[model samples]
Target: MVFLPSLPAHMQRRAPSRRLGVWLWALALCLCLFGEGAPAWAADGEGDITLSSRYWIDASGVQSVDEVAAQPAGTLVEMDGFRSFSLGSSALWMRLDLPRLDPSQRWFLLLSAAAFTNEVDLYQRGADGGWIRQRAGDHLPVAQWDHPDQTPVFAIDAKVQGPVWLRVMNSPTPTSPRLQLLTENSLQTKRYWTFLMVGGYLGFGLLVLFLGWVHARLYGDRAFVAYCFYVAFMLGFQAAFTGIGGLFFWDQSARWNDMAPAVFMLWLTASGIWFVREVCAVSRHHRGVDRFVIAWSVFGLLYPLLYVNLQTPAAFAVLNLYGLLSVLLSVALCLWTWRLGEAYSGWLVLGFLPVHLGYPFPALRSAGVLPDSWAMQYAVLIGSAIEIPLLLYILHRRAKDFNENRARLRALESTDPLTGLTIPLVLTLRLRDALRRSRRYGHRCGMVLVELANHAEIVDREGREAGDRALVVAASRLSAVVRDVDTVCRVSDTRFAMLIEGPQRPEQLKLLAQHVVARGLERVPTLPVELTLRFRLVSATLPESGDSSEAANDDERLMERLHRALDRLASEPRRVVLHLPVRMPAGA
Candidate 1:
């Protein structure tokens, strides 16, 4: 093989295109780097001395304050936080030269970093030219720290004529240190904004949980239940990973402070998998992806046990990579579900993409792949906070879809396709409910079960299709004759039932039945054979057929009485259109 850059003969014309693509890519990269929202550099009198260009690093990290101070100023190489390195086990000392300013000028040295650093020592020259030392970091509990609520911030006395010496002994990662000199106003503004973001993150989580719980109760949707668990577990994981759990929640319990991050992440992954399973109904569309999600959840649930015991740097990086892997898997699963055209897939794809992309920034920062910055440290939380509103909208859509689907399923189960009427089981339930309502509210309810006369004769002479047409016509007339409060249903090929809600007398019921039979007989559909079709209407009114407690509660007895009335009418086939009067049983 030749070791020269060459393109194949088929791609010779594409060389210019390839170079153009590279230039476009370079331009896009420049825009991404320079178009971001990083704070501007503050000059000495602008806000405070930024120390961005004023600081020099000692890579060996072994020199004493006096020994380093003894060297020529030219010996030190200037670097900003963006140009720092991995000082493994060795403490890096950063020296900053301060200029004497007016008495009104007050400067605070602020190190904006995660609170995981073990040791931070700040040495300043006192009035007598001796070193005055100040300590801060997680090595001491919050109560004992110089500034508890913040990352290491120290007050620098401007009386010193020499440089300010700072030493950081921390993890063996390539952390780009963030150091800033802030005026009192700038310092307070930073604290105010930080506190506001933390509070907003917490409040957003609680609001999502509360709304999810209420919707879950209202609709009883499994997706909503998954959403509640996902939000709760996600908040727990964020509280831990963002250092809020250690500093605020578990300050008294050292083991809890150490293990909360991994434990909550495990549970968050579990709940996240379950949430995806519910929203997408993954088993219905993609069983293979569903199985993988299940396996991933199980692994995540068990991984935290190992994390509690292995607290080293390697273990920490592995755990963070695990989280990144989980997010990647989730994104793939959602994309697969969307490809399968699952319902509500848009909600999942749109609501989860931001957080999934943002998850890696914090993870890569933890794994030492990226430098320490506000985006790496806090973007995950911020992105997830934005996801709350998107997810809530998705949740609302999911719940509404669930309820509509449930109602449609119920209708399919209990409705007759031919006549579009309630079927046997559902009609019976409606009758029982009507009986209870009639008793409870002291209202009257009536039912009429009509069986067609000459229906069998027409089928026997012509065909079953002819009888079906007659039944359809009779059903239409029966429906037209009943009031809107009445329900009409096809019980059998020749029988149609109507439940009427009216407090009319017995004669009125008979009159209504007569009108139904007459109209039904008038509109019999023509068959191939030249013949006439007839129908009979027999109705039963509550408290008129049987007054016993058994008839009131027993659905079978009520149906039996209507069938008996129909049987009585069947004997008189000579009658063209029969309408039976209300008759009480023997017990009543």
Candidate 2:
């Protein structure tokens, strides 16, 4: 097994900090996992705070105010539900307003929602009377509330200087809904810790990906490395949505802002499916599904970049829907791998369960139904943070076993177990390669056929094992006498063939043959081994008149005839002379 040396370009392009990068990421992830809670909520403005609960009501009492508030009025263009009153829209709407009249002060609105009758919209009104859109700079979608906080927050623009309205509304629907807006300054000291935790998670996630590339180059496996990329994307998404990206790498805000959730969910889903497919051989059963997943993932990945001009909420909705599709696909893949008895399936399902569980939060929050922040989506990232590495370790063990089995098969194919010589297939391939070189370099080559004389007699005298041992001993002696480029193989049960390359005279050949035969006879010192090695020399240069392949076939036939003649010679218990055609023998 000859290894090809690496090209100079590969050596030059090697990463210097690849391993260190991975370690750094691991350290960061560890810190995040054990860290304290998120940052404390603070109002840009100091003012009075109000606490209130709203209800979603329609013709009947089936829908809650929270449910109605959660969905966009446009989407609720035609919804039907039970409400106490005949508020006959598809959903209901309501709000908790901190109403006043001051023009000299800035304010922050922080609230915590308990539950929604269905789901509702929670927003903070600006002094200009417009809702304050939650935009985490360029890295995240434009959100209007504290969806990232899993609580409610409205960061009024620097221009909203004055008394502003804080309102939560539910679209009119058949079902009456209820939700609470609790808390004033949710962004407090806790935010400092949340920033640290989420930032570390993002940093470490990227580091893992960098290390995975290094490990793959060194060890020649890519599945684990691919999983690392998935983890990295999820962490990046968390960081962007949580505003940590804006806080530190503000320059990266634009790139991370829209791309965070879309790319994260796309890459994660695709990588997860690919990992499972490889583990379970899912392609064999449902290849089309895999193709669909890949196509959808690519589309999901491109959606953010392609639709940058669209509103953040709208774009986020589309992205969330894609994520939902990904989760469903992952679930399907898990089932398939499970049914296939895949060892990694259990861990994969466990690792991905949180991601799926967290999938609905984005869409729910985006539609104004779930009064939470984008930060809650990071729960999926946190879950994957713990699951990916453990699952990769499991895959690593399985891969090791698989590679070992393959190596064993390759060994069996190349070597003769009994005599420890090259098998016919291996010998033939080597001979073909050597013949090409010999012809190209104008060198001489020859072959010797050795046979055990009256080998049945040895089996009758001792046992088949003894006969086998005699053959092995003879093979070892021949191998010892041949050049490094030479090959010896058991071409038949009673016969062996040796290949010799490079220039050699007939006298040199005859002497070598006699020496090989003598060594075989000496193997059984007590009794006559009754073995004879026949010499059949064929040069690399054949007659130009004959076709190349046909001449080779004819040469083998000639060898067969010569062996028969030699058997006749040996039958008489003495050697005899055999002359060739007009072609001059080696050394003349």
Candidate 3:
């Protein structure tokens, strides 16, 4: 019976419950450290002032400022807070009643959700009592805005004042107007923080994307490739949704500017599903679920074309529904694959848990169930910041495990199971390479063929188990006697081969032969003391090839000669070592 050593208390495996506690603690610490803080100006209450606002819905979407002002008092409705309107060919007109302020102090009205508005036209009465119109929104370039910024900012005129009229036209998505009236100092503070936060997230995302790309190229893994695509589209979606794309990129193209968020969201969802499918290897286990995932991902990719053309509320609703389904599908796949014994799938689940938890906020916000808030805006961003790097690390670990398993398989195929030496195929391949090098470099290399001459007699007298032990002992002794550069191979049940690569003389070969014979004849502790191993060794220096044809069959010819010499040694009872003379080719 084999006795296994007991592991130390510290080295012993812990219960499954304790396995992930460290990771959980680390995640909690990260969340606490990177938690989002409320805007400094807003928290201080010194930069912004709250103003009462009323709104009128223009169903025709053709109402001028004068026409909106002429409406009956009862026609306008008081807004308690921000309100979201469904996408349609209607315009929302807001009337903001200004408060008396010092003329010297400059103030601006900030629309926190300006990124979602398609067209924002602010009408202010000039000193001359004439209406001055200023335009800002996704439909207009950020550079051309009255106050160029990430979101629309319109100057508040303290002098002219009965009321300021603002018209908002939404694109193919829900529009939620979150207006904040701020002083110049407060606006600058907000801008600074906005830039820092958004810029940091983007920079981190780009770094993760680049790392995923590098791993993709290094491992040639489709999962890493899919991850790169997922990250790229996710960044695009965030940039477009947050108005960063409109402010810096594609700002001049009004058509693309309006459609970017929707298009990127659709593509992001599709690519994320594609990434999950590859990472989980979903198709290999659950074919039906895999098919559904594929179909859903394709639908997400192509639905944007129809959405851009239709631009209907139904199309927008479909997009939101698809997003919700994609989240659920991804989670389900990871869980299913994990259950099916894919360890990486477990990491995928853990890596995306933050995203999964954060998704509901944005999904509800899109569906108009949740009001626009900081959670709705930055929850996904924070989650992605955590998820992206974790996923990349998971992929790295997966690739490493894959390569190690492949190497182990190769080792198993090439090495002997019992003796732990190279098998015949490996020996033959190495011998061929050695012969090729000997021919080209004009070096002398030798092969020593060792046969356990009493292997059958030992089995008959001592038993089959003793014979195996004897072979193991002989293999260990031969390996210990050879140099590190030489290869020891178990060629057959009782025979072994060694390839000694070198520029060597016959004297060295003779010495190596004697050492091999002497070591093999040594007593094995596992065998009986009375029994001794009989070893026959045939050593020969490989001859150089004369032509390409002879070179092709050089290893085979050398192997045949060695076996024949071993047979010849068997006939000579007194001889334990036979040294074959090196034969030169005709031309050489």
TM-score winner: 3
Residue 70's lDDT within candidate 1 is 78
Per-residue accuracy of model 2 over 1-588 as CA lDDT, tens digit each: 111122234332642235434644663464466432223233332322322323333445365434544565454222232123223234333443344423344334443321111133334446676554342223232242244443334544444333332223222211222222223334444455556666676666676666666656655776666566566666665655554544454433344543444455556666666666665566666778767756765675566565555534445556566666666766677666655555455445554544454456554554455434323335455555655554555566666767788887888778787887888777667656655654565554565666666566777786887678767776777788888878888877766767776564556656677676566646365345454433322222222212333334244453465456555656555543332221323332
The CA lDDT of each predicted structure is 0.68, 0.50, 0.79
In model 1, the worst 10-residue window by lDDT is 1-10
Error of 2 at 403 (Å): 6.6
Deviation of model 3 at 221, angstroms? 2.0
Q: Better model by TM-score, 1 or 3?
A: 3
For each candidate in turn, the TM-score is 0.73, 0.49, 0.81
* Order of quality (lDDT): 3, 1, 2
Model 1 per-residue lDDT tens digits across residues 1-588: 101133345434533444434543553453365333333444354333333334445657676778866778786657643544555667667776766644576777777554446567788888887888888665555455565554777887765667787777665344556676766676777777666777788887998899999998998888888889889988887776666665677655545654665688778877887788888778997678778878877777887887667656776666676677776666666666755665455447557755765677666665566766667766667667767667778779777877898888888787776666778777787778877876666656778888877788888987988777777777677888878877788877778888877564566677787887677546344864356546676776664433545445466776777777788877776753444444445455
Q: What local lDDT score does residue 52 receive in model 1, on the 0 to 100 scale?
A: 38
lDDT of 3 by residue, 28-119 (tens): 56545543333444523233222368888899999899999988999999887655777478998989887775677677877765556789
What is candidate 1's TM-score against the reference?
A: 0.73
Looking at model 2, report the run of 10 residues with the lowest lDDT sum: 172-181
**Which of 1 and 2 is the better model by TM-score?**
1
Which model scores highest in lDDT? 3
